[model samples]
Target chain A: MSRVCVPRDAATLAVGADAVAGAIAERGVEVVRTGSRGLVWLEPMIEVETVAGRIAYGPVMAKDLPGLFEADFLNGGEHLLRLGRPEDHPWLAGQTRITFARCGILDPASLDDYRAHGGFKGLERAREIGPAATIAAVTDSGLRGRGGAGFPAGIKWRTVAEAPGETKYIVCNADEGDSGTFADRMIMEGDPFTLLEGMAIAAFAVGASKGYVYSRSEYPHANATFGAAIETARSAGVLSDFDVELRVGAGAYVCGEETALLESLEGKRGQVRAKPPLPAHQGLFGKPTVVNNVLTLATTPWVLAKGGEAYAALGVGRSRGTQPIQLAGNVRYPGVYEAPFGLTLGEIVNDIGGGTASGRPVKAVQCGGPLGAYFPPSLFDTVYDYEAFAARDGLIGHGGVVVFDDTVDMAAQARFAFQFCALESCGKCTPCRIGSVRGAETMQRVMDGVDTEANLALITDLCETLKFGSLCALGGFTPYPVMSAINHWPEDFHVVRDI
Target chain B: MTSLEPWRPERGEEIIAGLTRLDGAVLPMFHALQGAFGHVPKETVAMIAHALNLSRAEVFGALSFYHDFRHEPPGARLVKICRAESCQAMGGEAASRFLLADLGIDWGETTPDGAVTVEPVYCLGLCAVSPAALVDGQPLGRVDGMLLVEAARA
Candidate 1:
């Protein structure tokens, strides 16, 4: 008999999975394991193969299981929850799936389930190739850090691996403090073993004996999931050589930065440190550290498992590999969708996201997190890539695209960008600390129509100073939203000038 | 005065005593004290200083550096509204205004009844839903003004 796989989406696994298992078992069919498809709303998405295709059903609750079973639903009988083909669904069809390749395809906590669906193949491959060869594979893949800052991942590993030190560390920045971004949280919670396998590979590559996952305290579920995953990995011998521990952060936005994350991990206040000596040299208690975002490290094992060229061939221009793009807010289909770098903002916002849920015209889409720039409807055609976004005064910040309808106020948004920086500023430098508060005040003046022209000029100058003088992006890129809002939606600013 | 009287037994004394025995315990002691009593009380700070043989100023500076440490007590319900970009992109401003208007208080201010204290949080990692907010540290996503009020009331 053909084995069928049914996912436990949002509801309790035993209630949902057991019912499906019991129903299928009664038919003398075997049941298999798989992870969630990340479309949380359409949960308990059941998949069964027939001569026609892989039939799928979703939003299936425990109460509906008996009816589904009575109809022999395992063999793809017509039901209210029936979705003909899993791959044919527009939501799943458009995704590229690099970091989240195994999600919804394997049982999250099961190592055996993972291995069956291409888990640890990267680690096993890394073990054969050795550290140097492994690093070369990543370098060839052209994989940049997916943690907002698009730094080369291989070069970072090389620095830590080559660093002449006995005590090295691998720190995963699971402190995803950016709004409109839950890729890290989803990866950790849904498919934690992949991240564990990836981190273990990094530990081996960097010759690091210890690894730490600095997860945000805001994601209690993610923290619990990661904590449990670490324990499971340790007992399963996957993390036998390297010790992995999870440190819960007390919900600080600045902790998302690599330097600030290290400070937080050290049990100090989450504040950004000056970088002359990068974390590669002085990090995590003054040891050579391989600090990478969750997505960056999660992609490592895959790079080793598949050839670097295979992964490199996926994206356009300087950007390579697939990004776990989160399609969130004011959209009909708000969920995680993976795609290559070449897709345009219009395609993502309209095509994939199915436009705004409000049925109003799409006004603007904010690419990246809080520090990212907001693109007006005019620039909707702009391609979604690192270099393209940077050219347009934006960054593909952690692949977060927040859609906004015409109801959004550009002036308020501009003011909020400054306010956010002021609140999150680590106060390591004056430009960020003093400049942000000044920027907020100046933006407020512009909004209030008090000396509007002078206030705009002052805000522009302040942004420049903060960009040039600040130590990190928290201060540096705070102006992206401010300038973009002013440039695109000039009418929003209370300027006295007549056309 | 009666409420303040219970604090005379060195409010966080048990926690302070437990943390004091560890090696390099100064930092851990302060953390434990803060964990026990939302913020490090003056008496607890003094006791920690005496136990760790560190100055009161040293303990105070440590307390001041961390954002989690607060000088005043939090309300029975702590509502943290996400001010991050995604939340902002999804009508967070309107939500904030509605909350302020409905509650008759601005962000970081407590209601007159001492029932709820609303503060602005950068992000709660519920970006997909957008316009997210948290009440008493429990995350609620895709929130509106009515939702915030309902959460506050609940």
Candidate 2:
């Protein structure tokens, strides 16, 4: 009679969560492998549906289960590990969760569980109103691409829908290579049906019979979860009109770029292609294709279910809808924090994140993954809006907020950014290919105090070239960190001269 | 450190044939080969090329371009450490340093004892519990020098 929820998320599983789930199930409770609630700090977070409410016991290790059982956990019993009523928890109670509303709340692969919790409502609505209306609804919703570009989603969909081709394609860019981002992975692993439904809806809207979810191999669990979900959807005949297949990338960061993703999809190296024969015009084997980030596609079902105006009602400016901002790194409370687009960086780092686990003052925060510009404590008031970030030489890239404490060396961090660029560059363009190596070496000189002023200037000059000269974001955005480090934390660079 | 299973030509051909029908079948075929055998065997280039009507160089070009595909054999265990900003902010660099020192091998090198091979991965999305590392593809979160060393040793 007891329904137990255990997160099968990768972070949870890494800490022996699977074994813990197995142990709990053997204790005579009906176990449900649900998606993570994004409360990563309290992972393998177990919830038992009891008479009182869903009593939670989190971060439960296999070793902790015996004590939980002894405490009579099944009956909502008292225990040190107990966190009663997940909703009442301050973390869950505070913010808007429209995008991730169903995440960690339902059994990921269960179509029935998904349906019970407002699943397929968007697709049903889309089907009822037809593709043209569905596209119009999305257009009205004001949902821009969550994949860093901030292009309108409905506009992109309409392009593929209207493009001249009987064979159109819906490609989900689940290759989330950005360091601080995990929203795409979480959606695929936790509520895969939503992503599947979104893709199916997209295929229907575009008149495409085929779809592909190009997930990164880094997320083995996500890839597996999505693969199983596809099979489940396939069996249930949910994919009658449109078919979806999962494709995986082999550790290529550039593959996250839409065009590069298309290249990799064609079974080739992930190299950035020239833009203007946009993927919409000629994509995926010379067919019109609609490439969207997982977050964008996943958000579609909701926009359809609720009218676009209703969805667009929230947030500020041109940036519409909510962002599933991931609070990562040194923060005390690290997890996915979903909120509207206008919250300040200060609010996210201090309030939601609860500051660094190191107890040091937050020195800086890097939003939108590594490609995003670093914000000093002074710029904490900066808003999370796409245009706002762009105005400040930053980006709300995929809503990943990586917080750093005073102990962090900005110079070293800058060097690593270029080094990462050097390591991951697709080797197609010269500026990124050559500039990154030089930038990294220059950063080291700045670090070593070798002609500090001159080296710093050289690093600054080199970054500009990489910023404008590189072929893709990998090279183009590496300068963000380097420049931000120099601009905001010049003291750190100056201190190296004393060293 | 888990090395790919020794390539069986028949099995490689079987994987290639099964996947060659899909659009952009080459990538899928390479992924399947790596999934079946931890690394795609060099022999797969010609087999996959012939099946997909691609040149061996084209196949090899793809195999070498992506960082995930390993060429030589790995060790008994694989330790992929997260060196991304999130991890670094949470002492990931220190954990990696400890792991490297403890194992007496640099990044991307196998231990002399062949106990483990270390590779620096960008991120594993365990940023919430920062300083994450993957020991044999199993993630370890909230890692420290001691934990990373223990992971490498294990």
Candidate 3:
């Protein structure tokens, strides 16, 4: 029987990959369920082992099974759904493929598969070079946190290493609550061993004996897959003396914040704690902790294996290394496009994304998540680097690019930014808690043509308060979307004014 | 999803006992209790507090802080629709409206017959597929109101 590969990634599974896999297996074929290739639109894409390498057919439903079998697709016969070799596809070919190098290609649960794909090389290298050198390598790599903060990963590790604590912890913030982002989830479900290896290296470097991956409850598939990978790594003794546990977070967006995540891990309410002691100095049960995002930790393995300078060679300016930019929403080719920084927004939203899925003119794109700014097509020339985007009041937060066609309502979207903050505010700070609700009401009055200009002014002032007064990014960043909407698409806000 | 058993103090205690020794066991205990009983029954708050050596106020505060831990039993199946920006760009609001209107109920409300309860979830990381939903914890993407209705009914 020929071996066929199918994605078990949550998005593909949601669209019926299981049924397609079952149908293929019913033909007495060996079906291997792997993670998604990040070519999301062609999900349930099956690859067959052929003399010319793996040939692909995709977006396949269960009903296509009989035809596929009849076409003798086991040997990569020509079919309507055939897309030739997957790597040759423009989408996959254009990507840099650093952190996500082995994602869709390997079976996440198999430590052997991971090893064969250059997995634990980083950990081995870290061990060989010793702890200080390992930390130095990451420091020299110029790698910053991919969790939107853009903080240096090596500095955090060094702080934890130097901090005074008998017991320290490594925490992986896998709580990917961003609306258009799924890179962390993809990595966890597709290449879990990489994350574990990275964590192991971090634990070794920081002198931490325990590590915890704080994941969200919404990611049931990722939690299950990563949990199994943890068991496999433990059994294989790859974790060595370091112990890692997967902790699930209840549905609290605020918990995605580092301090709140530590609070949630401590079995307390998911409330944000003030900074001064920083997580690296005192965190996670009042011990020095290294809290890093999933992407930040996962990228460590590559940084270690390839040498820090090699990893640093790519990406423009300070945003070194590749980012798994998630192209989503109304885009035609919605998938993770792993590339170096400096690609213009226009190129990403147009060339790589293939424009709007609805065949309409693209009006706006929201980078980052709910707290991100909305960029009109006018600012499409902005570069993808963190500092570059920040220069334009935009951010490459988590590298999520959500496209929207002309049919979208920026006024409504602005309102949602407030409403979402109101619904999810941790209630620790008064500005985010009270200001968000007030902002939502004012936006509603504007939408209803009641004192539109005055309400708009009030919103601008309130956004200022929410931006600077809030304790954390939750309230602090909410104004980005609100003000961006008012600035870029002012017509949407003025549509119902004083009629 | 399997049918949830009626809330039992013994079963709750047993679940709590298995995880009480874990560091920060409250959330896991809450999850287990919800798994068995469909929701964290009010009675188990005191039991969890006692077992974990925390105050009832602290336990309730923790429980109430999270949206996942419900205080009441849901319908036979739980249906969560995406209401976040990515989904909205693809007409999630319209689909959500269609489903809610069809069911003659509002968000977070159960159908009259207790067949399904619809809730608003921000995102399920299915933004690429758009208009996604979770029926009894199983994800479905590229959905419309009709599709969600059919899936929830199924």
Index of the highest-TM-score prediction: 3
Task: Tell me what TM-score chain B of candidate 3 gets against the true chain B.
Answer: 0.97
**After superposition on all CA atoms, what RMSD does each candidate show versus the true structure?**
5.0, 1.6, 1.1
How well is each residue in A1-499 modelled by candidate 2, as lDDT tens digits?
8888988888888767799889987867889988888888888798999998788998788999899989989898899889889988899988788879999889997899999999999999999999999999999999999898889989998999889968899999998888888999899989999998899888888899999989887788898898999999999997686889899888888899999999999988999998788999899987899999999999999999999999899899999989999999888888998888899998999998899888999888988888788899899889889988899999998889999888888988888888888888888899898998988888888788788899988888888888888878989998988899899999888764445
Interface root-mean-square deviation of model 2 in angstroms is: 1.0
Better of 1 and 3 by TM-score: 3
Candidate 1 Cα deviation (angstroms), residue A282? 1.6
lDDT tens digits, residues A271-390, model 1? 788886889988888999999889988988788888899999998998998898887767766778887789888888888888987889888788898888988878987888999999
List the candidates' TM-scores in order.
0.86, 0.97, 0.99
Q: Per-residue lDDT tens digits of candidate 3, residues A1-499? A: 5789999999998899999999888878898888899999888788887888888999899999889888888989989999889999989999999889998888888888999999899999999999999999999999999999999999999999999878999999999999999999999999999999999999999999999999988889999999999998998898899999999998899999999999999999999999987999989999999999999999999999999999889999898888899989999999899999979999999999999999999998999998999999999999899999999998888889999999988888999999999999999999999999999999999898789989999999999999899999999999999999999998998786343
Top candidate when judged by lDDT against the true structure: 3
Candidate 3 vs. true structure, TM-score: 0.99
Weakest lDDT window of 10 consecutive positions for candidate 3 chain A: A490-499
Candidate 1: pairs in clash: A34-A106, A35-A104, A35-A106, A96-A338, A180-B127
**For candidate 2, what is the total of clashing residue pairs?**
3
Q: What is the lDDT for A404 in model 2? A: 89
The list of candidate 1 runs beyond 4 A from truth reads: A1-36, A40-77, A495-499, B1-62, B69-78, B93-105, B109-117, B135-139
Ranking according to DockQ, highest score first: 3, 2, 1
